[model samples]
Target: MAPVVHGFDWPDRFVVGTIGDPGERTFYLQAKAGREVVSVALEKQQSAQLAAGIDHILDELRAQDGNPYHVPADMPEELRDDEPLDGPVLEQFRVGTMTLGWDPSTSQIVIEAMPITTIDDEDEDGLDEEPEPDELLVVRIPVGSARAFALRTREVVAAGRPLCPLCGSPMSPDRPHECRLPDDQP
Candidate 1:
């Protein structure tokens, strides 16, 4: 049996994809309610670390009925029109020393976050301040989906997949020149 770090009703409005390989790691988070998607990429090791971090985040998200973090409405506008928001937030969630490992037996991603101290920036003088901390959340996602997402992201980043360089449309690798219109034919 796969160890379920945490489980919650999969948000009707949320879908996240992650693609990782030995050299690159990419995560894609999409919010159906908001019609937003965020993508982030890191080095191979960093990506693994991020996957680990998300284990905790998924746990937290599942424990709560709604998203706990506050994202400004205007913040969505700041993202590139083509970029998704979920990927970036997931990437940022891992701040301190964190790592992610995959369990082949169960097709699960395991994330671990180490204990570390961070300063609360609420004070005016920028001094370290402590506040009542909330319980940490853990998230669990199926390993198959995670692997597919990671691979898709890597393909996009490597330019190995056929896609419109100008408009970012997924295209055929063998037909790179097919995009030209009849009038624009050379």
Candidate 2:
């Protein structure tokens, strides 16, 4: 069957949120355009990387001579969205691959998330290949919204289990953490 692309050119909302506790949380990438809403499950690392990637791209754009895009180094206050995910967070798919890019024409950040695909044996070229996913999510937001999205994502990711000061490992609130300290230390 042909692939289904859920495209949101100028979404009203786009953010990353979690549904569970700190130690056992499920991260989701959500996009809403008018009444339509789509959510996709993803790893915490992917969420962090997405935010970092957006920030990196915006920073590079802001550094350009004349700064045509008017990219902001910080998240705009007016665009900040701290509310919880809208509607029931029903995940459409688990994202396996994510791509980010800047659309110069619209001055927007483009984010695409594709579902996980199983790879079969190596092909004639000795390269493991995988089939295309049936569903995908494509969202585009302006520079300010992009910054806000990144900011909110960072906050959501950091809201997880606190790190252990001694071992620098995550400490669960519900259970004790086994801190693996350096041999040189106590």
Candidate 3:
């Protein structure tokens, strides 16, 4: 069966947002174009890495002598988006793998996310061929929007629960945290 693709080219909005409390948040990557919207659930680390990866790609592009892509050194202030996720944030899928690339023709950043899947023998039909993902979310955003997306992602990630001062682990907001120290440290 072919996978369903929800693709957005230069979407009107793209951002990372979370639901629930800091320690128990569910991160989502949402993109909207006109009335069409797609949201994919992903781990917090995945969100952070995606943002960093985008920045790295943009930085490499800007390093070119002529700066042909016109990649911005910093996110455009006017492009900063601090808004929450669009209401009724329904997740289309849970992301299993994410890939990023540059679209030279359009000078845009391409992001493809594949949904998580479990293959059963019955489902595989005893065939040696690999199975296709149930669905995919593909989004292409211009350089400026890409920069802003990365910036907002970082902020959303940082908004999580504060780390324990002693152990450097996330601390629960509603309860006390028992910090573990090394035996040698007393």
Best by lDDT: 3
Candidate 3 at 152: error in angstroms? 0.3
| Candidate 2 lDDT by residue in tens digits, 44-107 | 9999999999999999999999999999888889999999998699889999999999899999
Error of 2 at 174 (Å): 2.0
Candidate 1 ranges with C-alpha deviation above 4 Å: 1-45, 48-83, 86-94, 102-107, 112-116, 119-137, 153-186
- Residue-wise lDDT of candidate 3 within 1-186, one digit each (tens)? 878899999899999999998888999999999999899999999999999999999999999999999999999999999988998999899999999999999999999999887778576564765558979999999999999999999999999999877788998868989987977886
lDDT of 3 at 28: 97
Q: After superposition, how far is residue 147 of candidate 2 from its true place, in Å?
A: 0.4
lDDT of all predictions: 0.39, 0.92, 0.93
Q: Estimate candidate 2's RMSD in Å.
A: 2.0
Q: TM-score per candidate, in order? A: 0.30, 0.92, 0.93
Which of the predicted structures, 1 or 3, would earn the higher TM-score when compared with the native?
A: 3
Q: Report residue 104 deviation for candidate 2 (angstroms).
A: 1.0
Kindly list the per-residue Cα lDDT of model 1 for residues 107-133, writing each as its tens digit: 355543332346655656646453322
